[model samples]
Target chain A: MRMIPAYPVRSVLVLLAPCLVLSLWLGMPSLVHPATPEEIGLKIATEASARDDGFGNFTATQAMVLRNKQGQESRRQLRVKVLEVTDDGDKSLMVFDEPRDVKGTALLTHAHKQEADDQWLYLPALKRVKRISSSNRSGSFMGSEFSYEDLSAPEVEKYTYRYLRDEPCGKLTCTVCERFPVDKKASGYSRQVVWQDKDELRTWKVEYYDRKDSHLKTLTIGNYTQHLDRYWRAGEMTMVNHLTGKSTVLNWAAYQFRTKLKERDFSKTGLKRAR
Target chain B: MRDGAARYALALTTIWLAASVLAVEAHAEIEFAAWELSGRVSLESRYFPRTGIDPSHQSSNTNGFVLEPKLYVEDVEGRSVTVLPFFRYDSADPVRTHWDLREAYVLLFGELGENEWEVRLGADRVFWGVTESQHLVDIVNQIDFLEHPNGKVKLGQPMVHVTWTADWGVLEFFGLPYHRPRIFPGQGGRLRFAGLLDNERVEYQSGAEEWHPDFAARYSHSFGPLDIGVSVFDGTSREATLVCVPPACNPREISDLSNVLIPYYAQIRQFGLDAQLTLGAWLFKLEAMHRSGERNALGLQQESNATELRGIGFEDILGLYREEEYVAAVVGGEYTFYSVFGSTADIGLLAEWNYDERGRQALPRRQPLTLDNDFFFGALLAFNDVESTEIKVAFLTDASRATRTLAAEFDRRLSDQWSLHVESSSILSMDPDDIQWVGRRDSFFEFHLEYNF
Candidate 1:
């Protein structure tokens, strides 16, 4: 009702329409220029880590099956408890249950961001606790395809990342990225390539390259389940060694989150009673 | 009388089995879930390629079987109980065929003002040492030498153990009430000394004898790359002094009584320090101890316990020892090469030096003197494979006396519940003056197959 002149209204529309069109074009996924590959890679990793943060603590039981080229299989069972640390890497305790010869053996690890981790092994037969050298990160874990480094909690500071490309993965689009390990001397691999979903940032697959830059192994993760309405956890992981014609499959079950685990429970003194 | 006692034991065992069966039937599901039963059974075969020097014990082959059953029970309130019994039957050695209560203990865990505490009651085995070449600080349990000459097996000791964990370190205190005597090989056994050694011919310096109360305490802590422990023990010495009582007093007398060896236990106070430093792929270990109130070297005109010998002047007569204080130490290091030759197997080299101030006069003269003023070199191969295989070889030698020992051991899992072990050792002595020359031909090989459930 207050409009006075049609010429003023036409001039206002002409000035605002170009600005709206320009903003829409810039926001378009196909036309927009993304941030740098390194920045994007870090951003994705950080987001993925943040989503799984604040879990406080969790416990899970794992069963591993190892197969050789001759199709012979061996099995191992273990129970793991993890405690989340707000300022540092998480703490974990693993107790073996199979291969009855070492039924009550347990391993405790205290991970750090920029320094070597602290590890201890409890031998039930001897009732002795021994501190293991953390420099053997590349050594096989329980004679499986997974190395100690592969099984450790993936802390963002332990690697340098760069975004490679995005591709279709399974039923969804995934962002591909490459990461270089920070501890070159201890790590068996020079670099690893990861494929993660764009929506929830859950990792789907990874390829490991040996120090000589040859593809050494491939790990595929699947059967993701949501916990606490926000956190996603993989139920199964399979690792295959290309050079050795060997493979190991890990099946995780009975996951309980936020079980009110205390820091004192993860101490080296508690290792003997971990059973 | 022995048959009557055996009958009585059989009846008691039958009653216990009946009661256990009744209890299981009464609380089938409730108790079954809380109680866990598991253990190992092993079959072993041994062969001696070389004949021993003792003509009386000339057996070159032997076999044995061992059974160990364990029962564990835990409650939700941080209380648990464990019971394990061990039994072995040897085909040729009577002294090696024995039964023992390996462990029967109740453990209680609790927290006190942010500090954790634990208490253990009953019989248990506690080992404390970082060095592999010698366990100088491990004195809580008596060695079961009759089982193996390498001295790795131990007898359970009755003790009241308490552990307290604080921010500074872990403190452990033990009150041991019973002392188990070391049993020597029988006449039918292979690794026997040149004597008619009998367990009945044992003496103790303390009047209280095997009932003497023993005490030990240890404080252990870890700081980054280093882990250290300081321990003190006041108890009867585990090593028995070999004494030859008169009329076996004279060294030149070839009398029948001279062939008998008496084991004498002495009271001792030992202070021990053990430490290990782990850097990269290297591990450095050291164990040192200073002991008092135990006899040292043999000397002339020494006081003897034999009343007949006391009347004469030369009481030393190879039967007397003078009590003195001495220090012993073992230091070693191991360097590992992981992922060797682009393979998953890891190889490690180890070297250790053992020093004892008493030298060749170390009280346990009847046993091999491999750790006194000797150097040990060893290699360990760990094959990180599905079978979890490992091989270890060690060589120990005394440069001055020319006494050497070469040993090798290999073990691997044959299946999920079965495993195999093979061990061999050879000894060489060039110095006839060395006591080790008595059994220079005691080289042997052992094979073991174990099943676990």
Candidate 2:
């Protein structure tokens, strides 16, 4: 067998070294320039917000059961109407139907992407409309565990997020993340941790921490169903307040999408006529 | 009870029964399914710590019950009608054993000139004011004075109201064709100007009397955080100050010195403006009014003929009979603190200044300045529990008069259809500068039970 001279082989290797190094340097950016955790979180949020667009309008009925620490429970029933708003978040109206004392009570909310939302409460007894202050958004809703802020649809710009990790959540794999409210004064919670399933990118659970940074509440969402083959909504949501040992369960049913509701249907006049 | 009263009772019962049946039936033809029937039954008992001002008081206490039944019907085409009847009975006073059709109206809405237009025709009540302490600017409804001293109750006014809604503001035009006489305590009632109001001696500035054709217009709009309202009223004043030949308050009662207070309804033109500014957790409110022809007892005395003024104890009932023009305003605000007491409760502090530039009242001498010029401070605490319990305390004081009025109430819902309310009130007065509550100035505790359906 004939062998090339060792010196010649060495010379060729020397000639190729610089070229290999140059090639690797040119390809490094594509593999190493991964998105930051924040960028990934924002991407997920933006995707989620965009996914539910074009629903136009929808209506649904809900039943809420509130349980105090002593295990005593009371139930309330209401109907909700929602209208998709462009250049903003969404508009919604809630009218209570049962619990005679509060019947004919209605609430109107106009959510915004970058500003505090607008809210109005119509109490039948007074036959008047009262506007809720923006700073008071964190107050309890109708004496329930939920708050006025919680009733509003989540907007992408209202929060800053950090992607935490991927983990198994029930039957699906979820992308976990942490969110800090952009306007602290309007939120009762200092921070929140949420888990969103990867398949449909729908939120499955959220953990809220009070201003003191202690765990205050846990919200679990389940029984999700899709409408218009695109929009997804949970049929059941349960919120348990660890600090108070109280829990509220909301069960939504009979969701009707693309109801052709117009802006007029969400006006103050509509609120007064909600019955 | 009179025959007419009994007839009204029977008719109301039958009507309510039919409405209940319709509300239960699902017949789409008659549109019964679209009608809603609702009502309330309440039993309230008042215990006075002392005998009331009723110089003729037979009892120091009172037990009352009210049945308010309402029905709303909507046609398939969207036109709607509402009927609300309020029936109340009081054991202590015959004047309060009455029933009123608080609201019976038909509403229609449509679009006109790119603006949504709505009109209501029939007997209805319209309130216009921003003050929590008094309804100074609410002049549309004839006050039900016999019900409560603070003037919250009202008698329905028959009128046609048209509202034009635009993005900029809401413009309302009102045509009140008939006037309803204000109710006052009878001879045997606890609170009375004299012994009773002379129902037959009432006078009206308008020649049309109770059939006066009154009109008003209003414009209201909101800009960002501020809401503003401007209104003009030209009509017979719903507020009737009285004139007596010799006041029932006079120590020496005369056979010719009529004990009856004669109501005088003045014709006037009024301009009003109300504004509210919304800030984070705070709301600021202001209400102002300018009137041209309000009756002033002092002004009247200055114009009275010598014979009419002879031997009259004018100073004792000073501001009761004159007519004057003036301006008035009320300014206040409410501040709320969230999550009070480490619970899901919110506490709200409210303060208000009620000022009548003239510092006037009917029969000012006897009326004093008890509530005319006062500072009102109140607090409301709300619990976010399942029952949504709440407690409110309010105090009104006029430092000059050295008089004060305190009102407190506690409310809680026992169930979906039952509720309990406990309320208490007292007015303190002193000397020749007597408070109008006078003999009726007893501390009152009320226990109220209600059922809603």
Best by DockQ, which number? 1
Local error of candidate 2 at B197, Å?
A: 1.9
Best by TM-score: 1
Residue-level lDDT tens digits of model 1 in B78-160: 46677777888888788778877667777766789988888777777887888777678889988777787766677777778
- What candidate 2 gets wrong by more than 4 Å, as runs, is A1-32, B1-33, B193-195, B199-201, B246-258, B297-320, B362-370, B434-440
Which candidate has the top score in lDDT?
1
Against the true structure, what is each candidate's TM-score? 0.88, 0.86
- When only chain A is evaluated, what TM-score does every model earn? 0.87, 0.86
lDDT of residue B438 for candidate 1: 52
The candidates' DockQ values read 0.60, 0.40
Worst 10 residues of 1 chain B by lDDT: B1-10
Docking class of 2: acceptable
Candidate 2 lDDT score relative to the true structure: 0.74
Model 1 Cα lDDT, one tens digit per residue, A140-217: 998999999999978998888999999999889999999888889978999999999999999999999999999999
Q: Candidate 2's residue-wise lDDT over B299-393, tens digit each? A: 23333433354466634343445557887777999899988766788899999887776663433211223345778899999986788799999
TM-score of chain B taken alone, every candidate: 0.87, 0.85
